[model samples]
Target: MAASLLQSSSLSLLLVVLVAAASTARAQLQYGFYNTTCPGVEDLVRTELLAKFAADVTLPAGLLRLHFHDCFGAGCDATLLLKSHNGTAQRDADPNSTVRGYEAIEAVKATVEAACPLVVSCADIMAMAARDAVNFTQGPAYQVETGRRDGNVSRKEDALRFLPPADGNVTVLTHYFAVQNLTMKDMVVLSAAHTLGVAHCPSFSARLYNYTGAGDQDPSLDADYAKNLTAVCGGPSNVASVQPLDAVSPTTFDLGYYQSVATHRALLGSDAALLNDSLTAAYVQFMTNASSVDTFFADFAVSMINMGRIGVRTGTDGEIRATCQVYVD
Candidate 1:
C-alpha cells in the first residue's frame, strides 16, 4: 500500500511539473512581441504575403501547410525552412515533399529584415504568416503569439516520426497529436485545414487502388468519389497528379471538410478516421451544418494557437537566423 501510494504521488508530481513547464513555455510568447522592435512586423508580413497570394491564389493553402508541417516537425520552429545539407533535413522528408510557399516565406523574411533586421524570428514570422494565410482564404482571423526562436536542428527522421501519415487511422493520428500535447479535438480541428489544400496522388493513392493490398479501394471512401479520384490520379504510374482535399469548396477554409467526412467522401483515410471515433464523429456532424462555420473558425483559432506553442524555443534558447534556410553560426 505504501509503495503504491508513493508511485501515485510520484506520477502526480510529474504531471504538475509538466503542466508548469508547458505554462512557462507559453508565457514566453505574447501578442505584439515585436511591438517595440518591429512595430509594423505583422503588416509587413501581410503585405508581402498578399502580393504572393495575388499572383497565386493557391498560396494560402501552401503557407498553411508549411506552418503545420513546421510546428509538427519541431514545435513551430523554423527548422522546416532549413536547406538540407546531406538530404537529411526535415523539409527533405517525403511527407513534406509537397509543402510549398518557401519563396513566399523567404520574400516575407526579406521584407521584415529590411524593416527591422534581426528582430523577428522566422518561427514567429511563420506563425503570423499562417494566421494571414487563413484570413486570406476567408478563414478566421486570429492573433498569434510571437517571440518564437528558430531551432538549429532539422532532421528527416524527426519529420517522419512527428508527421502523422496520410493513411493514419484515429488511433495513429491521436497518438501522433497526443505526443505533441495536443488533444483529439485539436486533431479534428486542425484536420479541417484540409478544406483549403490539395493532396498529391501519392498521398492518398492507396485509397483509390489496392487499399487492402489486393487491388481494392477503401470501403470507407465514397465509391463515386474514389472513381473520380482514380480518374484524376490515373494508375500507379501517375504519381504526379493531385486532387483537391475538399472538392465542394477547395479554396475555402470552411466546413466542407467536415461535410466530406460526414459523407465518407473525404480524400484521405486519416480524414475518414474522424467518423470512426464517437467524439470526433459528433464534432464532424455538428460542423456539417452551415451555421457551424463560426464555431469551427473559433475552435480552429484556439487549436492553431495551441499547436503554435508546441516544442517552442524562447528566452535565449535558440538564435534568430538572418536567412531562414541557413543556420546562424
Candidate 2:
C-alpha cells in the first residue's frame, strides 16, 4: 500500500512539473532566465559587441537590423542564422544583402558554448546581441527577455515577403507592422534604427531617377535634398554605391532621424510615409522636435520587448542550436 501511494505521488509531481514547463515555454519570457543556467551570457555578448563596434562603428546598426530580420522571419527564433545547403538562407534575401555582423554572432555562440555547453539557445543569443548592439551605440539599455528557442526553418521566400520594403508607403508600412502585432508607434520607433546604416542605391534610386516609367522623380522628396542625393548617387560609377540612411548624425543614435524625416530629408519612402498618417505624423513630429530623448528611448525599449516576443518557440518545441548558423544533429 505504501509503495502504491508513493508511486501515485511521483506521477502527480511529474505531471505538475510538465505543466509548469509548458507554461514557461508558451507564456512570456523573463529577464533572469540565465541567472542560474548561464550567468555570463549577457556579459559575453556585450564584451564582444563593444570590441567589434569600436573597430567598426557600423556594426551596431548591422546587428540591430540583423535582429529585425531574425524576428520578422520566424518570431525571433534565430532562423536568420541558419545556413541552408541550397544557398537559400534568410541572409541571402535581397533586403538583407547588406547586413553585416554575422561573424559577431558566431563569435558569441562560440563564447557562450564554452561556458555553458548546451543550455543557451541561439535565439536568446540573438536577442542579447541585438540589445547589446543598440545599447553600445549610445541607445537605451533595455532589458531583453530570455528563454527563447532556436528555430529550424528559414526560407528565402519568407524574408522577401515579410521584410519591410524601403519603398513602402504609410498604408503598406502600417499593414506590415500590424500583421506582426506591432503598433504604428513601434514601427516609427524601430525605424529610428536607420540612423546608423547605409542603403544601396537600388533601395532609393527609383525616387531619384525614375519614380514612374516616364522618368519622373518623386514629388514627396525635397527638391534640394533630391538634388544632393542625385549628386551623390547619380555618378556613372555611383549607382551601386552606398548612402547613409541618416545624413544628419550618421553614426550617432539620437532623434536626428526623426528630425531628418520632419525636414523632408528621409531617404526611404516608408520613413517619409510616417508623416502622412495623423497618428504616425504626430509621433514623427514629437520625436523630431522634442528636446528630450527619454520618451523615444523608453518607447523604443518597450517596442523592442514586444517585437522580441513574436511567435517564439519555448519548452521542447525548438532545439538549442550547436551553432548560430546550423541546426543540431
Candidate 3:
C-alpha cells in the first residue's frame, strides 16, 4: 500500500510540472507584441498612438487590405497621406477614395504627442495601430515587436504604383506578392481579408461590365444594397466600376470572403482567381468550408507576422527620421 501511494504521488507531481511547462510554451507562442530587440524593431513608439490610430479606420477589412497592399510593396511608410489638403488627411474629404489607414496613423500621433511626446517613430506607431485596429474589431490580437526606425521619405505616386489594382487577375497579384517572398497560399489566405470592407465603384467596374456586358448583378448581392452602390458609383463605365471587396460579410472580420469565392461569386477578378489558380486552389478549398473563423484568423496572424518582417532596413541600413515625410537630420 505504501509503495503504491508513493508511485501515485510521483505521477501527480510529474503531471503538475508538465502542465506548467505547457502553459508557459503557449504563452510564448502567443506573444504578439512588438519587440524592439528583433533585428529591426523599435520601441521608441508608444502603444497609445497605436490605439488612437485604431479608432480612425471606419471601413472594414477591404480597406485594411488596400492599406497593406500599398505598404507592403513600397515599405509601410505612409506615403498615401502626402496628398492631404489644408494639412488634414485627403481621404477625410473624399467619399470616392480611401487613403487606406493614414487617418489612423494621424490619430496615433496625436495621442502619442499628448503623452509620450516624440518618443515613438511614426513608422512603428503605424504598424501597431494597424494591429490594434484588427483587435478592436474582434479580430486576433497580435504581439508587436518594436525597434523600427522611421523613414525620411514618402511619395504618393510610389504608394499608388506599388499597390495592386483592385481588379488585377491572379497572375499579376501572385507575382506582385511573390516579390515579397510570400507564396500563393499566403496570397489567398491574406486575400481572405475581403471579408470585412466596402469597395469603391471605380475599383470593380472591369469585372462587373466586361466583354459579356450583360452586367448581371451577383445573385448573392442584396438588390437594395446593389441599388445604393450603383447610385454612389454612377452606373459602371468601361473605365470605372466598384464592388465590395467581400460580398459575403463586408462588416465582420471572418472567413466569409473565402466562402464566397467557392460559389463563383467573387466580387473582384483578383479574388475569383483564388479558386481557379493552380497554386492556391487547395488553400481556397480549405478556407471555403472552414467550420470556424479561427482557421482563417490563425493563418492571418502568421501571415501578418511574416509580412511585418519584410523589407525591414535594420542595423545601420536605415535612419531614424524626425518626421515621417522629411529626411532625418
- Tell me the lDDT of candidate 3: 0.56
Compare the candidates by TM-score and give the number of the best one.
1
Tell me the tens digit of each residue's lDDT in model 3 across 156-255. Answer: 4454445566656678888777877777667877787677666666565544444246766544444564555556577665234445566676656677
Which is superior by lDDT, 1 or 3? 1
Each prediction's total of clashing residue pairs, residues at least 3 apart in sequence or on different chains, is: 1, 0, 23
User: Which of the predicted structures, 1 or 2, would earn the higher lDDT when compared with the native?
Assistant: 1
How would you encode candidate 2's per-residue C-alpha lDDT over 101-212 as one tens digit per residue?
A: 7888888888889999888998888788788877887889988999899888888887888888888987888788888899877898889888778887778888888788
From the highest TM-score down, the ranking of the candidates is 1, 2, 3
Two-way TM-score contest, 1 vs 3, winner: 1
Order the numbered candidates by lDDT, best leading: 1, 2, 3
TM-score of model 2 (CA atoms): 0.89
- In order of appearance, the predictions have TM-scores of 0.91, 0.89, 0.68
Clashing pairs in 2: none
Q: Where in model 1 is the C-alpha error above 4 Å?
A: 1-27, 327-329
Per-residue alpha-carbon lDDT of candidate 1 for residues 1-329, written as tens digits (9 for 90 to 100): 99999999999999999999986875578889889989988988998888888889899999999998999998888999998657889988999988998888888898888888898999999999899989998999999999999988888898999999988889899999999999999999999999987988888888878889999888888788888999998886677888889978998889888998899889888998899989989999999999999999999999999999998888878888788988322
What are the lDDT figures for the candidates, one per model?
A: 0.89, 0.84, 0.56
